[model samples]
Target: MRAVAVTAFGEEPQLMDVPQPEAGPGEVLVRMAVAGLNPVDWRIADGMLKDAGPQSFPMVLGTDGAGEVVAVGTGVRRFTVGDAVFGRFWRPAKGGGSYADLAVAGEKDVAQAPRSVTYATSAAVPTAGTSAYNLIEETRAGEGKRVLVVGATGGVGTFATQLAAGRGAEVLATARTTKADLMRNLGSAATVDHTAGPVAEQVLAAHPEGVDILIDLVSGPEEFGAMTRAVRDGGTAVSTTGAADADALTEQNLRGFNFHNRPSPQLLEILAGQLDAGRLTVLVGSEVALEEAPEALQLSRTGRARGKTVIAL
Candidate 1:
C-alpha cells in the first residue's frame, strides 16, 4: 500500500510503499476511496502528540476518510464487509492512519456514508463536520442569538456557519473579501474583512451590542483575546485551536473554553444524514491523488487552502 507518511517527527511527509494494515479485534478494515487532509496531519508529523501517547515510526498521515469495508475483525457487529463507511481513522497510540489505500478503524469510530455526496466529499466531513457540530453544541446557540465565526472560510468554519445559521442564530463570519460571498451563502448575516483591519472594530461597527457567542478558529492567545472583546458580557467564547484564555474569561464573568473534537459514530451518522437530506453542505475546494498528498498536506499547513482538500484514491 502506498501512503503519505513520515519516518520521524519534523520530517517531510512522503509517498511511500508500506505494509497493508488488517483488521484486529473490534476493528474494521476499509478499502479507502478518499481521505481528507486537516492541519493536524502536519502537526502530528511534527510531533504534536509525542508526549500525549505512543507513536509508531514511519507513521501514516491523516485521520478522516470514506470507503467500503473490506473485512471486519472478530466481535465487530456494527458493520460488515462491503458496507460503505466514513469517519476519523487515526489511532495515535498504534500505527497506521487514513492517508492510504487501506485503513483500519474501531467499529465505534465510523458510520455509513450518505448517498447524496461523493466519497471525496464524505471524506471531508468526519473531522471538520464533527468539530463544527460539537462547537455548536457547546455554544447552545439558537434563535435571537448573534454568533461570530472567525476563520469562516476554512473547513470547520464553513460548517459552523451553516449549523449556527440553521439554528436561527444571526451569524457574522470573518473572511477575506474573496470569500465573503461564500460565507454569506452559508448563512452568515454579515461578513467582516479580517484582512483589511481589526476584526473587532468591524464587527462592533456592525452590531454595536456585541455578539452572543464567539467561535474563534484561527487565532492564537493574543489575537483570540482581542476577538473575545466582541463577545457580550456573560456570553461565551470558544476556540478550537486551544487559544482561549480561561482565567481572562472568568475574570470578565464570561464563559470560555478551548474545544477539542471528540468524534463518535452517532455524530457522524447525524451529520451524514443532514448532508444527505440537503440540510447541510460540505465544501470541498480541491481533490488530489495519493501521490499529491505530500504537497497538499504542505499547502494545508500554510493555512491557505480555500476549503477542504481531499485525497482520492
Candidate 2:
C-alpha cells in the first residue's frame, strides 16, 4: 500500500510503499477513498506530541478519513464488508495515522458516511466536525441564545458556526472581510471582520450586553482571557485549543474550559443526519492526491486554511 509517513519526528514526510494494515479484534480494515488533513498532522510530524507519549515511527500523517470497510475483526457487528464509513483514525500515543491506502480503526470510532456528501467531503468531517460538536456541547448552547464564534472561517470554526445556528442560537461569527459573506451564508446572524478592528471591541459593539456562549476557535492564553470577558456572567466560554484559564473562570462565574474532541457513534449519527437533510455543509477548500499529503500538511500547519483539505486516494 502507498502511504505518506514521517520517518522521524520533525522530519519531512515522504511517500512510501508500506505494508497494508489488517483488522485486529474489535477493529475494522478500511480501503481508504479519501483522507482529511488537519493541523495535528503537521504538529505530530514536527514532534509536538513527542513528550506527551510514545509514538510509532514512520507514522502515517492523517486522523480523519472516509472509506469502505473491506474486512471486520471479531466482535465487530455494527458494519460489514463494503459498508461506506468515515471517522477519526489516529492512535492515541502511537503515531500511526490515516494518510494511507488502508487503515485500521476501532469499530467504536467508525460511522456510516453521509449519503449526501462525496467521499472527499465526508473525509473532512470527522476530526473538525467532532471538535466543533464537542465545543457546542461544552457551551450548552441552544434556542434563543446569542452565540459568538471567534475565528469562524477556519475548519472547526465553519462547522461550529453552522451547528450553533442550526440548534436555534443566533450566531455571531468573526472572520476576515473576504470571508464575511461566507459566514453569513453559513447562518451567522452577523459577521465581524477581525481584521477591521480588535475582536473584543467589534463583538461588544454588535451586542451591547454580552453573548450567552463564546467559542474561541483560535486564541492564545491572553486573547482567550479577553474574549471571556465578552461572555455573560452566567454564560460559558469554550475553547477547542486549550487556551482558557481555570482560575479566571472561577472568578467570573463564567464556565470556561478547553475540550478534547471525542468521536462517538452518536455524534457521527447526528452529523450524518444534518448532512443528509441538507442542513450541514461540508466545505473542502482543496483536494490533493495521496502523494501530495506532505505539502498539504505543511499548509494546514500554517493556520491559514479557509476550509478542510482532503486527499483523494
Candidate 3:
C-alpha cells in the first residue's frame, strides 16, 4: 500500500510503500478514496501525542477519511463489503491511519457517507464536522442567544457558524474582510474583523451587552482570556485549544471548559444527514494527491489553508 508517513516524531512525512493493514477484531478495512487533513494529523507526526501513549514507526498520517468497506473483522456487524463509510482511522500504536490506499478503522468510529456529497467532502467531515456539532450542542446556541465563534473562517468554525445560525442564534464570527461574505453565507449574523484590531474590542464595541456563548478555536490562554471579556455574566465560554481557565471564569460568574472532540458513528450519521439534506456544506478549500501530503502538512503548519484539505488516495 502507498502511504504518506513519518519514520519518527518531528520528521518530515513522505510517500512510501508500506505493508497493507488488515481488519482485526472490531475493525473494518476500508479502500480509502480520500483522506482529510487536520492540524492534529501533522501534530501527531511532530510528537503531540508522545506523552499520551506508545507509537509505531512509519506512522501514517491523518485520521478522517471516506471510502468503501472491503472487509470486516469479527464482531463488526453494522457494515459489510461494498458499504461506503466515513470517519476516524487513526491508530498510532499500530502505525495505521487514513492517508493510505487501505486503512483500518474501528467499527464504532465510522458511519455511512453522505449520499449528496463527493468522497472528498465526506472525507473532510469526520474531525471538523464532529467538533463543530459538539461545540454547538454543548453551548446550546439557539434562538435569543448570541454566540461568538472565533476563527470562524476555519473548517470547524465554518460548520459551527452554520449550526449555531440554523438554531436561530445570532452568530458573530471573527474573520478577515476578504472572508466576510463567505462567513455571512455560512449563517453568521455579523463578521468581526480580527485583522483590523483586537477581536474582543471589536466585538464588545458592537454588542455592548456581550454575547451569550463563546467558541474559541484558535486562541492561546492569553488571547482566549481576552475573548471571554465579550461574554456576558452567566454566559458560557469554551475553547478547543485547552485555553479555558475554568476557575477564573467561575469566579466571574461564567461557565467555561475546554472542548475535546468525541466523534461517534451516531454523530457521523447526524452530520451526514445534515449534508444529505443540504442544511450543511462541507467546505473543501484544497485538494491534494497522497504524495503531496507533506506539502499539505507544511501548509497546515503555516496556518494558511482556508478550509479543509482533502487528500485523494
**Reference-based TM-score of each model:** 0.98, 0.95, 0.98
User: Which regions of candidate 2 fall more than 4 Å away from where they truly are?
Assistant: 51-54, 92-95
Per-candidate clash tally:
0, 1, 0
lDDT of 3: 0.93
Predictions in order: lDDT? 0.91, 0.86, 0.93
Q: 1 or 2: which has the higher TM-score?
A: 1
Better of 1 and 3 by lDDT: 3
Model 1 weakest 10-residue run by lDDT: 88-97
Tell me, what's the RMSD of every candidate?
A: 0.9, 1.6, 0.9
* Runs of candidate 3 exceeding 4 Å displacement: none
Per-residue lDDT tens digits of candidate 2, residues 1-313?
Answer: 8999988888899999766777888889899999999887888788888887777777888888999999999999999999999998876344477999899888999899999889998999988898888888778777889998997898898999998888889998998878888998999999888778778778787677889988998888889899877788888887777898888887999877887877798898888888999988888999998888888777876788868999998
The total number of steric clashes, by the backbone 3 Å criterion, in model 2 comes to 1
Which pairs in model 1 have colliding backbones? none
In terms of lDDT, which candidate is strongest? 3
What stretches of model 1 exceed 4 Å from their correct place? none
